[model samples]
Target: MDTRDLGCGYDFEVENSGHVFEVKGLSGDNGGVLFTDKEWSIASEKQEDYHLVLVKECFSNDPVVEVYSNSHRKFNPKKQITTVINVNWSISTSDLNYTEIN
Candidate 1:
């Protein structure tokens, strides 16, 4: 996975699926911050400097996956910074062919 600057924030793209994800910085102190939405919600209060990834699984179902790291922080006095998270997903399945006679 690779990340690119998108002015507002950063864009994450998956290598295999080519799926893209975005991460934006919220205004205010980086404490007790919770990413809430109708689909999924991710809270990163414990990890002070972190990015929240909210993914919507279905119309009524969604899951928030948290990717923690120490790479996120405030570089300027204003304390405004955005971090991008890249995730590589891989799946493998095996099938067996069999014949039976009764």
Candidate 2:
């Protein structure tokens, strides 16, 4: 994996893949930018800048799943975004249960 420093955070690129994952470490009420490509149609609809966190997983034997906070705020169950996991994959969410890492 290759890591690049974005102004507000960092981006991770998985080997041999077109996907680029970005992460922003801003705090409450702050907004930051994430990955952008020509095919990002969702960005075109917005008049203002939007922010997103990027991640990449290339070595998983099964489909990877992710759980993240919504609205770019701190982690909250009411604002969680959980990706559906395929039946062929088994995942453990215990590591990601915390809102912040100390």
Candidate 3:
């Protein structure tokens, strides 16, 4: 669902739970994903139920997935472009629900 095209505002929109996901894939050595100002603007408007899914250690055969739910509306992690995303509240990984990919 991650697209190279710009201005789509997000990666995927799930129909079932009506949730949205902005996915980023990175190898463990690179650290966490970065959310741009444009992306943040979109997320701010659609914070109803959105998520940021970072698939870390992507180069490794077994990647680790970390989904930060409603992270858009939650934190104000400065205006810096390179900061790691932060969620102000607690959301269990299981609770950061997403649609199944075939």
Candidate 1 lDDT (Cα, 0 to 1):
0.36
What's each prediction's TM-score? 0.23, 0.26, 0.61
Ranking by lDDT: 3, 2, 1
Better of 2 and 3 by TM-score: 3
Which 10-residue span in candidate 2 carries the lowest summed lDDT?
Answer: 38-47
Error of 1 at 23 (Å): 0.7
**Worst 10-residue lDDT window, candidate 3:** 1-10
Q: Against the true structure, what is every candidate's RMSD?
A: 15.4, 18.8, 20.4
- lDDT at 31 for candidate 3? 68
In terms of lDDT, the best-performing candidate is 3
**Tens-digit per-residue lDDT, 1-102, candidate 1:** 446543323246455653344454433323233222310211222234334343333233343344433223321122334687999975444322343334
**Steric clash pairs (candidate 3):** none
For each candidate, the alpha-carbon lDDT, in order, equals 0.36, 0.37, 0.74
Which lDDT value does model 2 have at 18? 38
Per-residue lDDT tens digits for candidate 2, residues 1-102, read 445543323245455643344454433333433333321332333213322453234234442333242322432212234588767754458756744676
Quote the lDDT for 21 in model 3. 81
